[model samples]
Target chain A: MARVIRTIGWTLIVLGVVVLLYVVYLLWFTGFETQREQRDLADEWSLTVPDDPIDHDREVDREAPEEDDEPVDVGDAYAALWFERDGEPIVSDDVIYVVEGVDLPTLRRGPGHYPESDRPGGEGNFAIAGHRTTYGAPFWSLDVLEPGDTIHVIDRQGREWVYAYVEQRIVQPTELWVVGEDPLGSGAPMITLTTCHPRYSDAQRLIAWGELLDDPIESTAEGGERDEIPES
Target chain B: MADNDAPNGDDPGPRADPDGGGRGGIPRWVKAILLLVVIAVAVVVLFTTVFPWVEERTQDPTMGTMLTPWLAYLRF
Candidate 1:
């Protein structure tokens, strides 16, 4: 009967509409949740890391947060990451807070630090994972970064660790070795950033590796101009 | 039976009220269309606003993450 046909047609239309709206939610609306969380994390970072710069003489004897390094809670924000090209910031006009874990909930908040890896500015590998296409897509421009670009990580004490981009690789999600010890076999303090490969899909992972520069630029307590931190 | 079909050769179904609609109210088709529209709007609002708002607090596994395996299967 026409009524039966009409009912089926209406059901299909409703289902189609839901599917379309969900796609929109995935791509667009989800970012709102991330942005709000990022804001809260930024505020928390400022409160925890004071604006006052460390005294140079006292700082020389003090290492980059490793001496008193404590275990970070899984979902806690620990550091801020920003990108630069030839010393000019490439993206992240607002620094992206790196959460402590790569689990689903933690990553939905921001770039997540692999708990197995060393903390930012520590020895060995400091690995992080981020969403590239949704939840604010903090690493959306990961592919655009070229070797020799810079990634600056500001730790809890406001000390800036500058890393020079070394290489980028696209690998299967199962390639756990990419974040393992000395992934590049360089035997240096390195950083790894991972995100789902092929924008809008997660069939693979895009990894970018960076090595810490010889010296880290310490942010002055003033902390007003984060980018102006002179290379020490 | 032939009288059930209008001059345009279409059946509007039996009219209980005999005023072209049931109980002298909106046509059944119009009501059905309205219901569909309401459902579509609710779905859109739930996905866009209500769900995202709740997700910010609940931190539950997101639909995107849960559907990844299915999406990969569909693509392959």
Candidate 2:
């Protein structure tokens, strides 16, 4: 009986070690791997998103990327987001990339724009999602946004849509009512950003909402301060 | 006139080696049963716990598409 108990104890210890190792892989090593993968995505998006222009302003009557317009791939980066807090593209700051389609592959690149929703600066809800803790964790600092903070969404043509942060909420993943709405009733374009809450768990979801300002500012390739072409 | 057939004749049908199952000497049936149990546990743990935890932590962005349904099923 003593030998049996001792053997069982040893087996438990071994199993415990294996679980610990797997947890480490999930938390740390996966981030490094994802960052490497995101680098490739960023490089490819730099070349593609620019040449393809998407118009969100009704005044312009420009072509927008919808299912009917073109079949945007799931992982295609449609826009780039910059925080006004960052201010003037300094070192250690990167424009968070927003790709088309909210899925594992698309979000692995950065933030993912939910398909079947309005584009940035459009007439309706432009909902997006990202990872808070892993897969490059683009929205890791999302909690830091305060009401009235400015979020810049620049498009492939270097046109910038400025949105003012309104409010944030935490809800279950099933509480997806915040996703789609008629901005016409609200009389402005809206944005919704989502991620898992509590930093390390997915039991809940964190959501940030914003409203796009009218008369969005446009940055020309020649006028923009940055050397690289903008792809919002 | 007889084929030295162990199946027909009296050959204590494949007697266990005096030294037990194999090099480990624990008995082959015991090892096989143990392996099967481990695999079943691994499958349940992988879908119900490990994968969900990984998806939560890393967001499993690209593959997360497929895992969404599995996560939903295992939520309960």
| Candidate whose DockQ is highest | 1
Off by over 4 Å in 1: A52-67, A216-232, B1-76
Model 2 clash pairs are A79-A232, A80-A232, A104-B61, A104-B62, A105-B61, A105-B62, A154-A232
Task: Give Cα distance to truth, residue A52, candidate 2, Å.
Answer: 12
- Tens digits of per-residue lDDT, candidate 1, A144-213, equal 6665577888777777777777778776565678788788898988999988766776656778889987
Candidate 2 residue-wise lDDT, A78-165, digit = tens: 7777665423331116767777888665666678888878877677888888788766677777766654466677655545677776
DockQ of each candidate, alpha-carbon based: 0.12, 0.08
Q: Once superposed on the true structure, which residue ranges of model 2 sit more than 4 Å away at CA?
A: A1-10, A51-69, A86-92, A156-158, A183-185, A215-232, B1-49, B52-76
State which candidate has the highest TM-score: 1
Model 1 gets an lDDT of 0.70
For candidate 1 chain A, the 10 contiguous residues with the lowest summed lDDT are A223-232
Predicted complex 1: DockQ:
0.12
- What are the root-mean-square deviations of the candidates from the true structure over C-alphas? 8.5, 11.3
